[model samples]
Target: MTGADDRGIEHGLPADGPSPSALARERRENAADVLASTLETRDATAFVHAGRGREPSIRYCCESMPHGRTAVAYDGTTDEWLVRSADASDGHPAADLAATLADRGPEGTILTPPHVPHDAALYLENAGFEVASTEAIARARATKTTGECDRIAVAQRAASAGIRRAASVLADAAIVDGRLAVEDGNGDTVPLTPARLRIAIDEAIVGAGAFPAGNTAVNPETVSHPDTDADREALRPDESIVLAATPRGPSGYYGGLVRTLVVDSDGGRERRVHVAVTQSFRSARSLLTAGSASVHTVAADLEAEVRSFGLDDSDEVEATVSGVGLESCEGPIDGSDEIEPGAVVRLDVAARVDETSRLRIADVVVVTDEGERPDRLAAPAHSLSPAALLER
Candidate 1:
């Protein structure tokens, strides 16, 4: 239950260490080494398609992994890679990849992701390449190298700092000043009204050099918009706001943080909601050091903790926590899955006390093996004590 201030450090990252770009490069190199050694003994290749359209790059196989690609590639003999384009004039990045491989002229070429799509796997099949499946790809990506662990550590630190900034922002505002407010994407004013502290919390994330990647304000009257825009515009005060901030560090790699904030009127219902949510948050954090729990275990404990408080009439609302990393909602965590080291998971806890208010808490953390347990992260757990909240 100790707050970040009580810990006497800022998000627990090594800010003065090597530059993020350097760290990222080292991580990539380390991952490549692992892949090469493994693949040389086995038989496989990495196929990558990354970034958005127009800027996207695609490659079927590589001797070493692509510089910025988080995925790793295994070793192949011949030293030559190939490039075969369905349409040469199109100038696709995949074509370039084919060219790179052909230039190397490996002993034998494999067709990976042969059905990927235009500029993705289209040219691969035309060039006599074969395909790999979803499960095979997942297993390859799941294993992390030593360098990746180091970079992930740094990323977790960055995300934790961003979350702290968001929490700090909400902590600083007061309802006395005619409702200090911030504008949403639609330009609608979300009042920083007392009990509706999420408005301030959202603004805090923005102040920390990040964007709100997702939003959910579900209430009893939760404006169910058959249309998406209207539902986004009218979030009731009682609603829960699940906000995600993905910040791009100097190295161009992303670190993510997600938190839940809600506003509720002052009353017994509000108190209950706060207690339930606070308890759930505590239960999830307990998993961070216990090491006995998997990512799924963390989610299960949260549900059990909330249920023990008897807040919800039914357990219809399932998981509030998920795997978070380069992407905000990384998966395979909220179910019967395990969380590996260097995985960053964000826990979202929400409880509706009554019709007018709700309580939500989001905490960012990294899954580590540093403690006596399997999961550890640099970020602190979400805890709201009267003294902690009231303090500067």
Candidate 2:
């Protein structure tokens, strides 16, 4: 497979695009447009309780918002958007929403997300407004706008950077005691452990101006607990170190990348699985172009191919596929198994190669209107070879 050096790392996003506030308004209006379509009457109001103890649907409606803000948008009217704190002194954000609709704004039925605050639900019901929960916002959020796409791209780049940093670290390390280690300034060696590697990858994500989601994992993974030190084993030569990173961009979006890195090849089961997973990645990505049908079929075929290569763990151990966006998993792709334009899907081919080592190659990609190629946002080295991550 072609490496990052030959293909070149994806550069930074365009600097002089729309400001974050402008981007938020665009998302709000876009969400409102979807909300409008669901309402039976023209005067109905949809109140989305987002962030701060609520469903994080806030991310779909706006790029950034004050903590505890509730969204009240009118049916078919993008002109009026209310994002206010759910003041405790006043009624809850939901109660406030009901009051606002009755006293001043639209005068009809009310719509909210399926997971609404109990207080908010009660208040809306008591206000004599016909209230109901809908998946309209979630469905709307699955389709990314131009601004949303740009924000997610930045995140994807950060995720790629995290993986590259790990692979590069392995490439640069010197083998000591049959395990990879790097010499400290004091000449002591800091052996590569899962926790140590996780820190390295997280630092790279932060350096790229993104926040690590605290799920940076190293398989055959290094884990530490105050109660025990059982999982502090060092990575030995020729063993696979699967790096799975999720980094949150500055704009509250997330990017995902999962790749397996090995210090040296023993030509074992792990290596064979890596090749199969890489090919499966290519085949699955090719089928995800815009307007393509059969996401379920594609997912089934991809999983079947990976399983045929002799790796099997249930869904709890490996997510064969998921949608990547504001909150890691949301989608028409995952929900309905439909290929949606502007949707970012994580085609994760993960399975346990052996008890100690697992093989995974997951990439987050954007489904575009283009028929041939879906955009690989900030993708890193597809090759399992550590040298592939280094720049020429």
Candidate 3:
């Protein structure tokens, strides 16, 4: 099921004179060589420490150079890392970069980073270098190493602390005229806005030694507008609230968590939506295991469970199962790659309850070889009542 190009390091010139396909393959290889060399030079002094204080001097295969005009390249065959710096003494950085690469043998085809700036990519192509995507390098990083998992766990703890702090704020809030308000240290009742809640969550995350990398959404359930900005809304009594956080640890690994809370309510439609999402989340989590399932199969099972509750389809629900590590969302479950052991992933389920409100629940899970339930990172209770969250 793999092609010649897919066979890494196997591609080579044909026995006969190079055909167009063979020439293209050669170009790709040359490009890879250049990129690898560049990455080495950029990370020359880099060392990634593993868990338990073990340092493994590992280098990344692709990295952007600190200088804007030039990129680095690594030729695997020669084992040489070369830096192509722009001769900008004359003040033409782009032109200098182009000339530098042009003089270094055939430009062949160049592989660019996924998020490369458009101008940069265009410049390479204009300089006779065919531009290609570097997704393979990204896909290779989907499975987490032992050290990466440890980093992710640290971020998850920070994310949990943030959510818990926000929950505490909600629990002690007083409902005045249906709007939730909190008394300040001076005992003055102040209306709780979405911004205030977000501040509390962000502060908690930073206090726990993590960066608030993702948006903090504190949405009130009573608002019927789907696009209602959370920052502009006020928390209301007897309604559900959604709290979601993604915090990045010191190692730059991310952890995500989302939970729904309800004030003293009769547990009406909100409860039903919460139950459905929780079930779908569990179903999706169960499907993530090493070598047992693909992203597509997991997504299918999750969508099916959501539909069984008579909720909207996957499109409307925004159901997501994605790898979480360096990036908040990476290697979507629907990707062609199969789940691998040590892959940390997040299962996020959100369904609209009405025009004004939606219910969402998410948790990070780790794929293990044992085939048991994946390790849940954010182990806090999924749903909490106002009184329960208020408890010290």
Clashes of each: 17, 1, 13
Which RMSD values do the candidates have, in order? 8.5, 6.1, 13.0
Which candidate, 1 or 3, would have the higher lDDT against the true structure?
3
* Per-residue lDDT over 142-175 for candidate 2, one digit per residue giving the tens place of the 0 to 100 score: 7777877887787788788888888878888888
For candidate 3, write residues 20-134 as lDDT tens digits: 3443233344434444654354432111111111111111222221233443444333454444334432533434454556565654665555565576566666777666655
TM-score of each: 0.61, 0.85, 0.69
lDDT of 1 by residue, 213-273 (tens): 3231222134343234433343333344444445433222234544444433334555565
Question: What would the TM-score be for candidate 3 when compared with the true structure?
Answer: 0.69
**Prediction 1 TM-score vs. true:** 0.61
Q: Quick one: ranking by lDDT, best first?
A: 2, 3, 1
Error of 2 at 298 (Å): 3.5
| Candidate 3 wrongly placed segments (more than 4 Å) | 1-70, 78-134, 220-233, 290-292, 310-316, 333-337, 386-392
Error of 2 at 288 (Å): 1.5
lDDT of each: 0.44, 0.67, 0.62
Worst 10 residues of 2 by lDDT: 1-10
